[model samples]
Target: NGQSTNSNEKKLAFQNIPRLPREVTPFASFTNVIELDQRGPLFQGPGAKRDTGRYKVRPTDDDSMKRAKKFSMEQSVKYVLVRQQQHQQRAQLDLIKKQQALLLMCR
Candidate 1:
């Protein structure tokens, strides 16, 4: 849990950003979540870093499960995109004859 103060100085998320001394960044493990940043930049304004990525190291099993979840999500999105494209193409083709008839009548 972390907390911070907003412009109004109101109490906020108790989470804090994790940072390692420059001297220790090299030693930091990529898998070890070195930082915990929650909802900070969103309130930080333009100067605040948006979509800041934090690093974390999870167990190898957890990593695989995460990958599987991500892969399934991405695959579903791709499948939908392809399906939509096919539907759109079919619609265009189906409408072509009607468009040609309208053009002939207009001429």
Candidate 2:
């Protein structure tokens, strides 16, 4: 009895299934319109490729470039100062070593 009842319930459920293609017609038309809009025009004259909008132009302001150049200059100056300090320390060490050697010889 239970098996027969389950089969009848499944048969009733199958009767209510909706047709998909008919319901999706509006969506298909919308997608078709979008595809038509995306396709660019054919028959281009000579040198027309340069005028196309494929490559979007960026802003003309050079603020970022100027900032990058300033940062590079600041880094270079820091490196130069650090190297100069290292050289000065090395020179001082050499002078101290020479004085120590002279004192040892006097002894």
Candidate 3:
């Protein structure tokens, strides 16, 4: 029994021994994390270099301006036609409701 106790004490002393600095470095348990930004413009195309200045006004070509004006006018005409169609549909609905009321009164 005394020999067994002495062996147990030796085992505990070995376990409590101070480890070397290299052995205790914890390099295997450490982690390093790096994050990269993914926010800005996806494709910095050729035009980006020329667009550095905020207040620089680029002149619009006459041809493009004319085309834009034509497109705007066409959109306006389309909206006017759609509005007329909506008004006609509402007038037809009101006429149908009035006719329904008159028939109900006669009955």
TM-score list, all predictions: 0.39, 0.44, 0.44
lDDT of 2 at 9: 97
Off by over 4 Å in 1: 1-58, 101-107
Instruction: Please identify which of the two predictions, 1 or 3, would achieve the higher TM-score against the true structure.
Output: 3
What is the per-residue lDDT of model 3 for residues 1-106, given as tens digits with 9 covering 90 to 100? 9999999999999999988686478665666689888997798787676755667434676677788999999999999999999999999999999999999999
lDDT of 1 by residue, 30-71 (tens): 665578668645455677657768767579978898999999
Each model's C-alpha lDDT? 0.77, 0.83, 0.88
The count of backbone overlaps in candidate 3 is 0
Alpha carbon deviation, residue 9, candidate 3 (Å)? 99
Evaluated against the true structure, the overall lDDT of model 2 is: 0.83
**Cα-based RMSD of the predictions, in order?**
24.7, 17.0, 14.3
Off by over 4 Å in 2: 1-61
Best by lDDT: 3
